[model samples]
Target: MNIWESHRFGKRIHLTYHALRRMEERRISLDMVQDLIEKGTLIHKDEKYCWIFKSYSHRDDNLVCAAVIRGSAVVIKTLMTHWQEQPE
Candidate 1:
């Protein structure tokens, strides 16, 4: 199954310990994760590509999700957030 299928709320998603830690560290909410999976633009796709999207929060931080679909599960490898620099 692809990452989309594996990310179904009813389906199973396996977040690696590192991913979980990163999410927590970045204050990423489950809603943000879901938003990325559902609405984020796919920048690239190999085994998987980093999903880039704005966070659901008001801060609108840029979120990058790295995940791979394994069997019936979506294994999230890591998550990162960055502030977009405003152009003058």
Candidate 2:
């Protein structure tokens, strides 16, 4: 897990290592994800199961993230159906 900071409205946010890598590889910002999370625009999985991470970008590039589910976290490139199997 990466360092997380809670926003004023109680949203957990941080620069994912993957996001940082993306920044280094290309150039993206976690700001979009942060904004969506803050505004509650991004609804990932329910709190009972999974929590989704968000990333923002000026370029039309795929956003990736890492998440801890069950007891492990892995890097993910897409959230489309069946993509969870890659992490599995």
Candidate 3:
């Protein structure tokens, strides 16, 4: 696992063993997760990329990937909605 110097949630970010297991299953890279946690906006809920100095991503080379860094192994909690249900 690649360890990155990243900042996490303002307070405590709780994660679960099951979440970690899910991440592993999704094949989401740790570096990508680090980019999420270290950078992105929390409340904005924007996709494409993380928020490092108000950065919004325009790159689409990688779409099916999502990540978050920091927290106690449980950094992400996603509920795939209708949009995600559609075929690209």
Candidate 4:
């Protein structure tokens, strides 16, 4: 299945295929994503997507980010490390 559900902080989060692949490639685990969803800061958000960023003690990357489309259920669009904030 391209979409799967994960629970964090009693909220249902859905990961898209692209998000899963990026997670694997970036070596970001499901736990990391869920932790981020629970604890990360909301950096930027528009009508289409919301970006969450957090620093991990185990990782060297300054920050890990998840791009999510929020609704009744949050759909994680992708994940990234060493994220540099871009201007809108």
Candidate 5:
């Protein structure tokens, strides 16, 4: 399998330091993010990254994240607890 596909199947995933900080600040648990990587949809993909999102509606907002998967790692580039617009 390809690296990204391997990651989706629970291969070793290393988060960047920035990603770790962002997850903590956003109160996003590692398990939550991991689940997204494993089961989230690939919303967008560029030459260097793949964006995966797992969205859930809570109250009037959406709890979601746009993760940038590069190589064998998933980096949480943007996370929103009450997202309004579709993640890019």
Candidate 6:
């Protein structure tokens, strides 16, 4: 688990154990996660979860996203790459 107190956003963000493992497997760095949380587009949200997306120039997987649970402390559940927007 990893915790970041984001002064810019005024919230504590936690990367859960599962999220950490996924991040490593996906080759997603901590800095990328931070940027996603801070600047990514909010593509979906419900009462408890939010999906944030962003496009990066460095990778073949241009779009990456993060699944996060919203609360006093935002918990990042997972990270994904090569994300495609599904038809609603």
Models 1 onward score TM values of 0.60, 0.36, 0.37, 0.79, 0.62, 0.88
Worst 10-residue stretch by lDDT in candidate 5?
1-10
Question: Which stretches in model 3 have alpha-carbon errors above 4 Å?
Answer: 1-15, 44-88
Which pairs clash inside model 4?
none
Which scores greater on TM-score, model 2 or model 4? 4
Expressed as tens digits, the lDDT of each residue in 1-88 for candidate 3 is: 4333334544444334554565466554455455555554343234422222213244333333233343344344431111121223
Model 2 CA deviation exceeding 4 Å by range: 1-12, 48-58, 62-88
Runs off by more than 4 Å, candidate 6: none
Residues 1-88, candidate 2, lDDT per residue (tens digit)?
A: 3334545334344454555565455543445444433443233454433434444444454333333231132222322211122332
lDDT of each: 0.58, 0.38, 0.38, 0.80, 0.58, 0.85
Better of 1 and 5 by TM-score: 5
Better of 4 and 5 by lDDT: 4
Show model 1 residue runs off by greater than 4 Å.
1-11, 45-52, 55-57, 67-72, 83-88
Question: Candidate 1: what lDDT?
Answer: 0.58
Can you write out model 4's per-residue Cα lDDT over 25-62, one digit (the tens) per residue? 98988878877888898764776678989999889985
Model 4: how far is 2 from its true place, Å? 8.9
**By TM-score, how accurate is candidate 6?**
0.88
Q: Pick the TM-score winner.
A: 6
Instruction: State the local distance difference test value for candidate 3.
Output: 0.38
Candidate 4: worst-modelled 10 consecutive residues by lDDT = 1-10
Scored by lDDT, the top model is: 6
